[model samples]
Target: MPQHTPDHPTRQILTLDTGVDAVEPGPDQRWSTWPSIAKGQRGPHPHPDWVVTAAAALDTELGVLKTGKEADVFLVERAVPDDPDRAVLLAAKRYRDTDHRQFHRAGTYTEGRRERRSRDQRATQDRHSAWGRSVRATQWADAEFATLCALWEAGAPVPYPVQIDGTELLLEFVGHVDDAGAAVAAPRLAQTRPDTDLLADWFEQVRSAMGVLARLGWAHGDLSPYNVLADGERLVVIDLPQVVDLVANPFGAELLHRDCRNMGAWFAARGLEVDVDALFAEVFAQAW
Candidate 1:
């Protein structure tokens, strides 16, 4: 029989008979009651510390953050045992159930992406097969993780990708903790209505961020206010699994044009005099 710990109500502790050794949970175990968060990591950037290491440990699931047609985003917390300060909260996006995903749009979005193997390419195309579903899940996860890293390094407003495990992706959480110790995700730009000054400032940030992407010869395939999170004075872009390649994909130019129009219209609707043509021209000039 197992008993619950007082501090960790959800954890169960098992006691063995006398003269027998008790087996405690190790780093490899992902127990429901394990404490998340480590020590000495109270810095601004709280990314995962163990990505390429085999000595990495399992993390605790906090809760589900959001759901989409292709994936469900959950909150995960990982920390070194007995070290609370080094703990970090991450957005764990799990890609599952390809049948429920809107993969019909995959062909157009993945035009520029190169598959490492023919099997994977075949599997991705055949979404009805088991191997196909598995490959699609991993492919999307890998694409999102890679895009996040690239955009972050390129100084674009996006989340920092920490690690990718099969169909799951660990990314930086783009929200702040409230005064009551509750985690609050930053509202999407669509959910916000800023004043004149703040709105103008936000537009500038959005334009600059988009410029960064254009300079990298990429375009967010799905650019809208709903996927952009407003974190105080900054804007963090999300959902990059469908990022477009400006050179390889024939529809790349169209995607960039659409993105510029979408964002420009958004700002214009708010009474901001934004030049969509100029923005598109600038991006096109920078694209190779």
Candidate 2:
């Protein structure tokens, strides 16, 4: 007989007894969603070694890591039963459906973006419809996932996008395990109090990351210290659903300037002697 879980409405789990007893999933766990979604929904080719693709794996919801205007991030652990070595933690960022999301400035960020299908375009405009809300939710998730994939491939310091199912995006957890064996999320760059040498190193990493985006003709539309994670000495830029195409978006240059100013001011406040104008000029030059 097959058993159904409330969380996963699409799949049915069959608890078949084969000489060895089947391990029934616990209340907080469900079968890994890898085999259910199409391969195209998965991460880029040559998947990272830590990504568990086994059908037998279970995904356990750990807890909420963050909440924002558009989405909420939760900690998830995926592992095969009885295989401790195959376990890995992932940050599951689930974009809220239209009804729940409070992103009032979406239009500002999506100025030059277009829906591929005419129907989708129409639905996105008709926010009152259920279909419209669903489309809007997935749009942000898809955008962020695609952006992370591109940035990671271009050698930027960003989390590896694992996969996206509907509006939920799974990414490589950019944190370390604590002494108690519990995963501790990396502190945001704004929360860190780095010394002189470390501050300079952090600034250099941010400069290099911004350079990469410039080369790609894109800008982290709302970049700030709050959205960057400080994992040891490495800085990982996040919350990139609003990445602007330098040549396409009307406010691209303005957004780029703001990004430079935002990060520059933070560094300067710490006595780093950052020149916002020079930083913007250096990045803007590479955009061409």
Candidate 3:
């Protein structure tokens, strides 16, 4: 029998008389998934220069950034070995399987949405069926990826959607490296305590983003301080899987109003006089 010494806790090696023939990836590192997925599954054309698309690239999972009812977000670094310049950090949001997901409000948000395939439509409606559960699991991921791409192109303050592979959506990480040279996710707006001027600026950013969504006849159906990330002076909206079609969804206006009130209340508590009704009226006016 040959003796082998493990290089890393997550690595495994098999040695033969000839030499080491096979090795398994470490727990955190895996081959780039980009090459296996279809081109159509990739992000929009003219992908950002930072996006790592090389076939030789490897993805190393840093850690989990967030965990929610529908999905969990992980920090992933994609890079080619020995190529430091070709590296980038991405937020990989992986949706839960139907068995684990708790999409309590999915019906309400998906009211105006429909599956293109009749089979999928029928399957999604049959919640108890395995096929239906699988379809439902992927639907939210697909929806969010498409929404991010459209919003990014329309100039909304959204994270760049790098690509979506099944239920895992890879997005541009929206934060700076910390003093320790580690990636730190930006604080949620709810966690920030800003001065009056900065608060006002943040409000303007939120308002501008909402206006863009309104003009597109859509609404961030679940907007709240918790879903907005404050990276320095910049505000980036996240978790838009439930974006509503203001014209087509019956509850669109109601959801839009809630979005305004949610953020307005936050600003109001911080000494910013936010007129929720006025904000709602202004945003709704742009839907036409």
Candidate 4:
């Protein structure tokens, strides 16, 4: 998610990759919109140490199920801390080493959630310096961790954060014992339709996940194709690194609503129809 610079780097690839649906890169340069905001995270490398620690904790484990952002996910069998014989398959999320420049503008999502009145006050101030960046990076990782834990507690469809072992975080793996290798590429509500009953069940999971978010007063800010993995019976949401601010993110409702819409569209593609507007209306009805 690089910034919307005219010629910095990935801009060319994105232009070539998604020319039609692409929102023309803005020229404001004030760090107000998506590209400028996304620019802070310019690489796939983990911009935080927690991510690296997360990876190191799960490396070289047999049967590691891979799926995630910032950190690589592995499905590994390890003995439970309390019971040595009770080995379990855990999905280990490890953060890769990402540069600090990737998070200079992240204050926009965090500050708004804690502020009293204004959001622009601390949106993108001088936080890219040595000390400021270090603090901001921690805040960024913590925020994502909060959302992941929140989703886990709310019974949303995602892996639970088992333990934050320094940089490595562990959770119950999604696939079953036999189907571990069947897990395909990241699957979002935007892609794939297995069958009627299966697609219907997935719709329920997606909707139910959104319901959990609304009940908890949060949004899956980064809901999209790249953040999901389709294992036989479930739609597991990944990528929590950039989940938006429920308050400051001008697109919170729209983001959540679009999540519902995306799921609805996916269902429709599979001959299952749903009223996208009604779904959105119902989920955020209490909020508005």
Candidate 5:
């Protein structure tokens, strides 16, 4: 193990030591918007703390790349900058305690049933005792880190996970952190303003991604227009917390089939004659 001292160059990565001051068992209603998002939603948002922590840990002051409903991504620095591509970007998933009494998120998002179950379990656990908050916090930390590592090892185009501590996740940042000139906005295949050549390129990229999926024994459980990012000539996939390991799950084959089908459907929607069945067959057949 590397002995990372306080002043060690690698010590730029920070820690999620945000103070948990709420001793009493209660929920914050202001940010509670999900049906079960905040069931165990406790304390204030630790993202800011996590952000600062990740930056210090990675040894770079990460500029904000983008902000979504659940997380914020930042382009942090690499511990050693000798190599130009040696730096790492941090995607600090700010834990959202958006669970409230008004909305039913459980009914809305049908993507990752397992993740949903974990959320519900945490929420249930959160309501009963203060320890539920601890459990929920640790679970989210584990899920994101585990998936990020899996994809990286599987040759998937994703931010590589460095280390996951507390509510913070340190990993390789994607793109130039989304700037005007260096930004690669996630191109919804449905809305991409590409020519025929670009369309073919996209088809090949999605197909290659499917290959990566099949080779890795996993599949993007909810691949669609939103998850694909157009990084210049290459189309990179993101938001894969629901990626399932096919070799581990019996229903994984169906998930992988649906993944290719989903991508094929996107092409078909654009008037391309995509044979979803053949594509599914090719992806599932383990010739490798």
Candidate 6:
């Protein structure tokens, strides 16, 4: 047992054996030695090349960002040691604990989707089988990853999907660092109160993003202000695990209408002049 200091009695102090005399270390010396990423040089839209290389060298888990019924998001720091420019903050979305997830509604969203192998499809259908459970979980993850890649390629304002490892997804963090040097999460649009002009701007931004989805013949099945992030002046759309193919799904039109209504209601509540039916009509006009 070591002697405890009266001033800081609760903290454990270790006496390290070095070639020189033992000394009381600085406060920060006891903390992690990994270099903090001062700032990333990847810019607003990081290229796929950089995201891939950086994610391969992820070092630490900062903490949990948010919790949801389907998945939990964590803040992760990835870096190449000794290089600040190559480091970045990433959102690690882990789709875990299928027992707690709302997978019962899976059938509705997966109506138009299919498995390439008949055996795999059968396995997914059999809820009693272990293989079936595994397939169902993997299916959810795969769907989101595919949707992210598709939307990103189409030039939508979305988090850059870095990589996917089984049920885990690594994506671009949507917010900036605070004055205290801690990472600050982007608030959901539901939590923000922008002025009249900024409110209109936000509506336009989200409307444009919704237009991109409409043009692709896709509907964000669970679209709502709660899932959309407000990063300063920009609105980044997220939570795409239930994306629907407008041309293939029977309930696609209803889903699209609901999305427009959800967003329109939020803007309208904030005194923004927006018509839900008009927005839906404009979006559908560009559909395939």
- Decide which is better by TM-score, 1 or 6: 6
Q: Which ten residues in a row have the lowest lDDT in candidate 2?
A: 8-17
Q: What is the lDDT of every predicted structure here? A: 0.70, 0.84, 0.84, 0.51, 0.52, 0.73
Better of 1 and 5 by TM-score: 1
* Number of clashing pairs per prediction, in order: 7, 0, 0, 17, 15, 0
Q: How accurate is candidate 6 locally (lDDT)?
A: 0.73
Model 4 residue 213 lDDT score: 73
lDDT tens digits, residue span 86-167, model 4: 3344465665544623333443444346522233224324445564434443444555656776666455677555455434
Over all chains combined, what TM-score does candidate 5 have? 0.58
TM-score ranking, best first: 2, 3, 6, 1, 4, 5
Task: Highest TM-score: give the candidate number.
Answer: 2
Better of 3 and 4 by TM-score: 3
C-alpha TM-scores of all predictions: 0.79, 0.91, 0.90, 0.61, 0.58, 0.81
Model 1: per-residue Cα lDDT over 58-128, one tens digit each: 46566789998789999766554444434556677888666677556877888978888988887877848
TM-score attained by model 6:
0.81
Q: What is the lDDT of candidate 3?
A: 0.84
Error of 6 at 32 (Å): 18
lDDT tens digits, residues 1-288, model 6?
A: 953221201111111111111133232121122222222312223344434353233345668999987889997765544455555667888896567785567777777888878888999879789888788777877788778877876777777776676787778788877666678889999999899989999998888888888888888988999989998887889999889888888988888899999999999998987889999999878886
lDDT for 267 (candidate 4): 71
**What's the TM for model 2?**
0.91
Scored by lDDT, model 2 comes in at 0.84
Candidate 5 lDDT, 1-288, residue by residue in tens? 953221101212222212222333223101112222232332222222222221212244435666655556664443332332223335445544433122233221223335445655656445566656555545545566676555555555664455555565655444443333242334445557667677777888787777777776666766876778765555767766456666666567777777777888877777667888888788777424
* Worst 10 contiguous positions by lDDT, candidate 6: 8-17
